[model samples]
Target: SVPGPASKSIITGAINFPFPTLRLTLAQENLSQFHDLDDWGFQQELEENYGRVVKLTGFSGYIDRHLFVFDPVALHHILVKDQDVYEEMPKFLCLDLLVFGEESSLPWGTIIANIAKTMMPAFSTLNLRGVVPLFYEVAERLDFNSISCRTSLELIGRTGIGYSFDPMLPGQEQTDRYARALRGLFVTAFKLQLFIPLLPILMNYCPRRCMAQEGGKLDGSEEGKDIMSLLVKGNATADAGMHLADDELVACLSMILFAATDTTSSSMNRMIHLLALNPEVQHKLREEVLTAPEHLDYDKIDALPYLDGFVREILRLYPPVPVMFREAMSDITLPLSTPIIGSDGTIMHTIAVPKGTSIYVGLAAANHDKSIWGEDALEFKPDRWTKGKADSVETKLPGIYGNTMTFLGGGRSCIGFKFAQLEMKVVVCVLLRSFSFSKPDSGIRWRKTGIMPSPYVNDEPKLPIVVERLRA
Candidate 1:
């Protein structure tokens, strides 16, 4: 059996106590610590005390034991080599169905894969280059107070679906019903986390309530330049078997909007925050952007070495979605890069995971693993990418981008990663070129809200940065 902290209650397992109770067990403390937003210390402790792979007791003593895995070889197997076996949990799919819509007869994975394939050209370098000016247009008018959410929504709206959520004018408020609902979805989802099992029952009462209101009208006909338009066009031409149903198309609209907005915005906000903290690094990056040609197309922006390194380092260190969950569909033997001793003191190379076993893919932990990324893994050093140090890092971990699990890996990996990268770089370049950012008076705390964490100041979702315009 895998080694793990003992559970206090066999029925509750390692479930965290809501009320403060005296004489808590180690298992309770471990589980409680797991919920912390800044989990770096907890991750390190897990690695030290329990190795890269720790068995966590959840809900039930033995039946509900979950594996918290950050082991490189195990991660590769779970994320890439044998991803099909470690599929999304049913409850999660139920949550998706609740948010998106009814799943078609086709497997959810197949649907996502098809949609991702159809949308590839839309996010291609040549295509995204045309939208650089739009990104800058939004970035230039950004207010640091609510910059991430509103700006990201407007950018995605204009470039992603040929819509405009906000006009970016000073003192203007977003009045679009769809945009309001879309922005609220994350908070709604976060509140509904505990009720995931009841999502199926709730679907019967409020079937696609959120998406059905506005998403159905987004038929990809507006201007015909956005990704939604391309998807609709592609689906029109695809063979009968490959054709997406009406609901599926609608789901895609909401999915793209919801997924793209929060993650991209969170990352952008974090980048700005990091820049404010390290003025020297920010100045250096700004210099790189400034020294480049006045007009920066996709190629020119991408060619900036320091800018690329800065983006890469931020994504590596602070992946918007820090963790992802999966469940085993069948009995499988999971491989590990290093052998670990079992609870019985036996050195084990491979572990047998039965069907229905829960698995937690520790993305942030893997990115910060000192063994793979060297001793200074915890430091925010963008130069590692430019200094030949990145090459020394282990390559066994499977990630879609920058040798980190920020975007995950395998068929279900983030399809719009390229689009996101382009969006982030373009916005960063535009913002840095026009303005200088400094830390605010109050400390910023990144709280895990929904799928992505957001910056909070004094318990409110705001990043109050001191911004000074450098040029008119």
Candidate 2:
């Protein structure tokens, strides 16, 4: 039987004895259960079974001993106060290096830190005005009944890196060559993830087979002014450590394309799905969006309160990358906000972790924690943002935007968070202004596919919707 409150452990003169920790098994017996739980569901299970923070070990294969953290205070310690102690998983770093072709971590890390500063204006409220027409044009062309992947790719291609994957004019051949290349890159990357030791060799040869070896330039009106061009030009003026080689340039551009495409598309799909299910919310959003002038600039469109609230709510509830893996760089102690009873009946205020310990930072669970977001934290309620209910809830999550773990926090936070927000707002506003969306007879479900949590129906990534033209 589990220990009761009366069974407290006796403390020694100085040393606090370690409690026997729980073992989270990924063995054959529970593999099905692990797979059955979606990202949010799995995190929920962890917190429910083992307090907000727990140690998971006793794994058989490649799985290593790790600490699972869902408590905000522990999260604050790991991701904010003493982030250097918790380094990003080497596998993830290897993937980044393989994708970006940057061997110099110092320069790449420095560049990532300043990327938002350099690129913010391009994705800013003022600069995004230039792309509003393009966004609307694509929105108007969306079929809505089937795949929206192409629409997202086209958006990122044109405005993000100043490339184009779709045909410019009707009767022209499709410029989907870039899309095909990216598909190959992702497939190769997946293989590399499984065999990370093969990265050095794979990185040397994979680009050739993945359609990135030929080295092609983007064709568009904004060609010279695109982010890629800016990066290339900036690198030219930078020191050797900060400069990107030819292969690195290709890898970096391709990485951005991969990062922006599926994630943003999935997010847009979720927003539409949620809005369609909730007619009242959709109507409110439409009302707010329509209130703005037809010629509204980026700043004007961004200022719409209802729209902002709805987006924030969706991101909070359904972050794309639900959990991230990290490893302890050295021995460290993490402070906890609330004391938890250990397996041996000792109350733990702080947890000590040793070097090489694998750690899972629970992003979705932390976002939905009742202690932080209140009783209705699990529910999808956008009004939390409007009436200042969310503001009242105190949280210590180190997120980059909207005080949520959707974009993460600390030095390694998502750099394109602002760009993503601007893109989402622009897409949502343009779509809401022209069409009223309703859930189709067929329902949709969200599942994690190692890429991001995306809408799926019949075991495929899809969002089926009924779009009605809103008469002005």
Candidate 3:
């Protein structure tokens, strides 16, 4: 039992450990279609299968993992108390490979700090303030007419990169080309997922050219200086240290755009869907926005208890980063308030773990856990936050600001956490002020993109809802 949740996987999945990998063997053919992957269906599966804690042993095809469903007290000991013994898990080790086109430390170590270091500066007040006008510009452009999700992504590319692309903005071949490129990259990701994990057998002898296929030539130039340029010119680039390769640029910017455009936009669209269904909550939120102060300072925006609660509830109910991974770097014992029930999971005061284990932390699972969040955990109840009754609980949870690792906690938490909150608050204010929206005649459901969990992207966020200008 590596004390830390981040490093539990690799440690527990080692040959010496007893947990079984979730990756099904070829014999188990229908694994992928195990569930319809609908809202409640997937949630139930997670609760039943991944919801429990175990130390998995041996490999199963592409996956090597040990899910830990230990009690909250045990979670605290591993995460905060004995954090050093555990670092990030093995699966998460390659985050650099997938996200930054770089290498991640086997034992998490300073990787998260590196992330914090590289990205935090980009969200500085000056930089954040600079993005607001652009935020409005982008949102307004999308609101003008019904657009496909892919088109919205193109809009993101243009607005974010400072290019004038009209893939959705009328006829612009330049914009059209960018859209094609973006589609190609997404296709690459989808295909790579199926072919990868050939592991030492195939990857070692694999062609370097194939492995080195980059996302390819996205236009990073914008008006004066975009965030990409800022990073290129800022301290992150100056302090690039050997790890900051030129290859890291597109990937880094990709991640930023994913966070900025995809996650934020998806969230706003979901809020619209949720509100359309719940008129009372919508009315109250609108009322709150109407009373919001004029200046729109970051803190003031965050200070709206009802609004903040609504966002938090939405995040808790429909988190974007549904899952995360970590690898164990060494042998350690996991201290637990709850004991593993199996033979290998015997209630030894502590659990043993080995190196190379892949630990998967289901943030969504833990967030909605019945034991921690109370019986109402499954239901959407924003009042739990506003009421403050849940806040007073003296549990092993991560604490309000840093406790719950939604934006992820630890050295690798989301640096843009503050910025994201500000953006959401601002958008909520703007939309709530401008209109009272409702769903279209045909009922709509947010589809999944598999990256972030729900309020899915089936239509690329075309909610099919109609909006009338609210009385001024």
lDDT of each: 0.77, 0.65, 0.52
Runs with alpha carbons beyond 4 Å of true place in candidate 2: 1-40, 61-63, 102-134, 143-146, 168-175, 181-223, 234-251, 387-389
Q: How accurate is candidate 1 locally (lDDT)?
A: 0.77
At residue 200, give the lDDT of candidate 3: 19
What is the C-alpha lDDT profile of model 3 across 152-248, one tens digit per residue? 4544444344444453345433345534443334324433553333321221211122123221213333234445555555533364373455444
Evaluated at residue 202, the lDDT of candidate 1 is 39
Q: Give the per-residue lDDT of model 1 (tens digit) for 1-472.
A: 7887666677667665533353256445456567655554765677668878898877667667588898888999998889888888876786677545555676666666777666666677777777887787777777353667888888888777767788978777888776676676657765556665454333332224533433444464334556766666767778887777666666667667867887888898899899999999999998998888766887888888888888889999999888898999999999989999999999999999999998989899899888888888889999899632375885567887877888898878888887788888888887887889899889888876667888888778888889998965
Could you tell me the C-alpha RMSD of candidate 3 in Å?
8.0
TM-score of each: 0.89, 0.80, 0.70
For model 3 the local lDDT of residue 438 reads: 76
User: Ten consecutive residues with minimal summed lDDT in candidate 1?
Assistant: 202-211
Among all candidates shown, the one with the greatest TM-score:
1
Cα lDDT of model 2 by residue, 52-126, tens digit: 876543233123446667787888878777777787777677666655554654534454555444444444454
* CA error at residue 118 for candidate 3, angstroms: 3.3
